[model samples]
Target: MTRRNIEGSFHLSGGDFTNAGAASSELKSILTNLGINPEIVRRAAIATFEAEMNVIIHAVAGVMYYLITQDTIKVVLNDMGPGIPDIDRAMTEGYSTAPDWIREMGWGAGMGLPNMKKNSDRFKLDSVVGEGTTVEIIIRIKEGKTE
Candidate 1:
């Protein structure tokens, strides 16, 4: 992995359904502008969007950080809110704590964390009940000469 040459951060407010995907969109644009591999970009975008949605739907506030090096893309999402009390349960494919309103809006299908894990080459999640949660996603980049 090469040293990071691109980095950015975005903040998310809880319950901001109107702007939930902004960070993911920006990250996707950045990766595209950097000429990242299409598959890697797609994976990164999916993972990021899921993480961002989790923060918007479940946390009081959060921040997302993106770092891109020659051989990888890394994303970290940290949020302050009611943390996951049962991570194992939270990781289950069809379990969700999202309210009905969120579901009515077409999100909170209990797939966010699962999809993030699926799309990321490396995924880590941690939470402390009553405190917050943090998720890290990393995607390996196949290196090639870039003009």
Candidate 2:
């Protein structure tokens, strides 16, 4: 839990497929400029992109908050979408509720949560049926670390 003051936000549109990765890319650029490790930056960027995609293809709209510190980056994604009825099922690889159209866009491969988990040092989610969903991810900046 590295501590330092940090802040950022990513806004995701409901159907912004054309610009899905923009926010993540911007954050990656910022992190890179901050001298963060490339691998850590990649993991954080990929995870953020996946979350943004989820908002587009599923949630319709959402916001991602970032907390940067000396050694770690924390991301919190919140969305007003059809909540996951079963967290266990959703966490499994190859599980997706995206329609065929979204799949056609190459946006939904049932890998959102799994990829986030794989890329983050810590991953957690809270969702309620008919309510919404929130996901938290933490990535640590370090040298010679591979993920």
Candidate 3:
């Protein structure tokens, strides 16, 4: 037997809507192959997708790093861009700073942060107004959920 762990990282470029959600989709596939619970996978996918989109919509570049285990899926998104000025307002489901063009494409509906928090068992968001933002999402897998 060899030693291994389920982990991966992906990079994203700002305004690259063409590749949005790719990383999250890969995560879903990995978790499915590992026999993790579908529900957990779904939540992780949604949360990660939202986080990924956030970086694409607002940052110059970003990376998503994830670690999976028998008990949890942990995802961290780090980006370089104009950080949130008001986390509270940003967390509101209907408030978005996304430009009109993004909304015209049917995104930036202001649900990203809210939805991310909703699907994560643990959520942490930090930002510097002019620096960047970092988000961590952790989802717990029940005892029998991992095979």
Q: Would you give me the overall lDDT of model 2? A: 0.85
TM-score for predicted model 3 compared with the true structure:
0.93
Residues 1-147, candidate 3: write the lDDT tens digits.
Answer: 322567889998998988888989998999888887899899999999999999989999999999986678899999998999999999999999988999998888999999999999899999998899999999997654542
TM-score of each: 0.93, 0.90, 0.93
| Residue 41, model 3, lDDT | 90
Q: How well is each residue in 41-141 modelled by candidate 2, as lDDT tens digits?
A: 89999998888788888876889898887767888999998989998998889999989988898867899989999998989899988778999988877
lDDT of 1 by residue, 1-147 (tens): 345578889999998988989999989999998887888899999999999999999999999998887777889999998999999888899899998998999887889899999998889999999999999998888645331
After superposition, the stretches of candidate 3 with alpha carbons farther than 4 Å from their true spots are: 1-4, 143-147
- Model 1 scores worst on lDDT over the 10 consecutive residues at 138-147
In order, candidate lDDTs are: 0.90, 0.85, 0.91
Question: How many Å off is the CA of 117 in candidate 2?
Answer: 0.2
Q: For residue 6, what is the lDDT in candidate 3?
A: 78
The runs of at least 3 residues in candidate 2 whose Cα sits more than 4 Å from the true structure, single-residue gaps closed, are 1-4, 143-147
